[model samples]
Target: MHAWAMGAAVLSVIASGAKAEEVVLSPSSAWVLDYGDHRCRMTRAFGEGPTRTAFMLEQTQPSDTFSWTVAGPLVDRFGKGKVQVQFAPAFDGFEIDHDASLRVAEFGTAVASVTHEAPPPTLISRTAKPRLRSEPDALSDGTARAARLRLLNPEHGRSIARLTLTKGGESVSLSFGSLEAPFKAMNACMDDLLVSWGMDPAELREATTAARWINSVPLVGKIQEFYPAKALEEGAEADYRLRVVVGANGRVSRCHMILLSRGSDFAQRVCDIMRREARFEPGRNAAGEPKPAFFSTKISYRVY
Candidate 1:
């Protein structure tokens, strides 16, 4: 799990520019994941004339985990953009769901956006292995690092990530170790970085935002199916989302839903399954404070 490979794996996904409308201006993409946790956030945006278009995904919460991808044409694609997304709970982990999309048309100063959608099933892992590729560049005034990380379907070996890192005039070709175990690759990179700074992973895990992962099994499953533009009506199967917090005791302490299907029973079922199977390891904050952090996930219902 070298830094070069890891960074490549994680960045590949972002580099795979989804087919955005031509009207898009200064379009950008972002991916964020919680280490060892099943939650991830992805956002994309572009500008039109007076409006903009945006797509956001937030997977994993205290109660469940799910994912959705959507796009739309908007009036302007600039300034601040807002997006809404949806998915299913971890219990309802087997189903197709519908998500939302937003668009805008302007170029402002904001650089990032928050989104909610279920993450890819393969990305959900207890450890991450991110590989980064770094190259040196020379400019008239100084030198810099250029990098890219591959982000993609780990099981299928598809390149889904491409990350770029630049210092001064040179960019670091940062990437994940491989297209496989994106989560693990990231973990390895983070660990290496901490160690390089003469710090321990445990020390950082303890003080910063932390989560006590119980069970700690690698849920290496593939996405069996994907439903596009399908909506749940009444008992006709529902859509839900959940976020879980594994405490130091190795058990689920909190389960929250960012979205739910048509029934309360759906939400309850999601919580029940997670509580029965989740695990954890005691965590610490940046200041070496022992506490339980949060890991969010999403789930959807399917005929499975």
Candidate 2:
């Protein structure tokens, strides 16, 4: 091997195998899969004690993408601001690029999370029918991207994942052992979750569309209305996850929330905002029939 190639190989080994200053944690707990009214989460902790790192992966529907959140003292390694999160886990042959939200507690612990989504640039594969005819708007950009993302589902024999959190020259990496089994459990939980929501799992797999937000431009401004007074007063920060049910009429029927930290006031305010202003283009099933679906996301508030 050339001098440079050998050097690079040695560096890889050092980064993955051992690095004292860098926090590299391995699984210290079993996966806990939770099926909630709005989402499914698979969680596992690495290392031990108060400083141990905890990871949570959540999914709300049958989709290739999922949300990943990590917490604990491991979070203290990065700055309180946005962290460069690179999930290059081979995520089943697909990659994810998005900004991760970071929160540092008053006591100095922190948490970071981000969701994976395939961009609109996903093109048809070689297997696509070359001569198939369809309406110009039938296969929209979003539709094609969803189809492509579905192929990256971790349940499809995805290997172990190493998620790296970076800030300038400093970085910390966490490795999640073979995720195939945990993801399978999460998928099963999701199937039941659909049933609890009165949705047919099989039919949803063939859905022609997922709920789309309408007039969401003002959403951020509206959420800003809350200001999360209690949290700010206590000098605490939090991020809340939510799922809103969209009726066949495309209006938000109800909203549910799960807190990442203590902030009930903020959560309540967000639900109120969603109920009053959230509108959507309802999802449709394979038979072109309107279906009730959910839109899930997370929101954070900063006092400054």
Candidate 3:
């Protein structure tokens, strides 16, 4: 098999929803990882020159999710409606909401962040709580990719390299070679992020029974009223993430805005609402005693 076909992993999502013209963007740069105070991001460029289209994956704390976004000039041209992002050699594909994000349809470097039910957990979405879903409803893109990357050892050249993007019938594939080091760095950075959040990396996996969002419907309704006016005017959307710290009493202590998809501000309003109205069944330690714990969730908001 050719190098391109070797272990080709295609990390694809519709950044914008306006049907793309005849354009195929390929890999231009190596994957770069950034360890920020609140998040871990891994980015790569597609399209041979000027970094026209770039793919970004960011995770704040250790979770099966990413603020997966694709940016560049051509993004605004993508068509609206349903689009699919595929993780090959394993499954066919899944859908992403393209009605917003890059749909701004303006010229010059448009940024589109899609609201997927799962992003990484497929490259972005309204982050869902980490829970057990019966059967396949539980298997997510982020979860699958993380699992695959972790097992990238012993089977070295079996995971990363040359991810392809197939959108609107135009084919854009990457030429990545060995994700060993990049993935290693990304994972290490995530561990550090967890620690920064006052969370122990080793204990979080199963340390406490995962936090639960028990009463949140009213909060979501209130959030719809706080849509940023700037974002509304530009037709921009969001898949905002929140890090909620639940006390042992099954109450929210505080909240943090970890990721914002749009270029405007609505996170404050949403986080404020969450802190006041959102209630959860606090997580408990292995001893079945109430213990403080935090969880990150993706909240897709709108003005309706």
Which model scores highest in TM-score?
3
RMSD of candidate 1 to true structure, Å: 17.5
lDDT of 2 by residue, 1-304 (tens): 0010000100111243233345566666666777666667776666656447777777655555576777776566564555566554653323233232444332235454435442322111122212212112222432523322132255443555677666545566766645667666666777777677666677656667767776565764555555544555675656555667778888888787666545445567778877887777777776667777666655554444
Residue 7 miss distance in model 1 (angstroms)? 29
Highest lDDT: which candidate? 2
lDDT of 1 by residue, 22-55 (tens): 2213333333333323334434443333434343
Clashes of each: 147, 0, 23
Instruction: Summing lDDT over every window of 10 consecutive residues in candidate 1, give the lowest-scoring window.
Output: 138-147
- Stretches of model 2 off by over 4 angstroms after superposition: 1-25, 48-53, 60-63, 71-111, 115-152, 155-157, 164-175, 213-238, 260-264, 269-280, 297-304
lDDT of every model, 2 decimals: 0.34, 0.57, 0.52
Looking at model 3, report the run of 10 residues with the lowest lDDT sum.
1-10
TM-score of 1: 0.32
lDDT of candidate 3 vs native?
Answer: 0.52
Off by over 4 Å in 1: 1-21, 24-52, 55-70, 74-235, 238-241, 260-265, 272-281, 284-290
Query: What is the C-alpha lDDT profile of model 3 across 153-224, one tens digit per residue?
Result: 313324544444445655343344444565556567877766666665565554435566666555544554
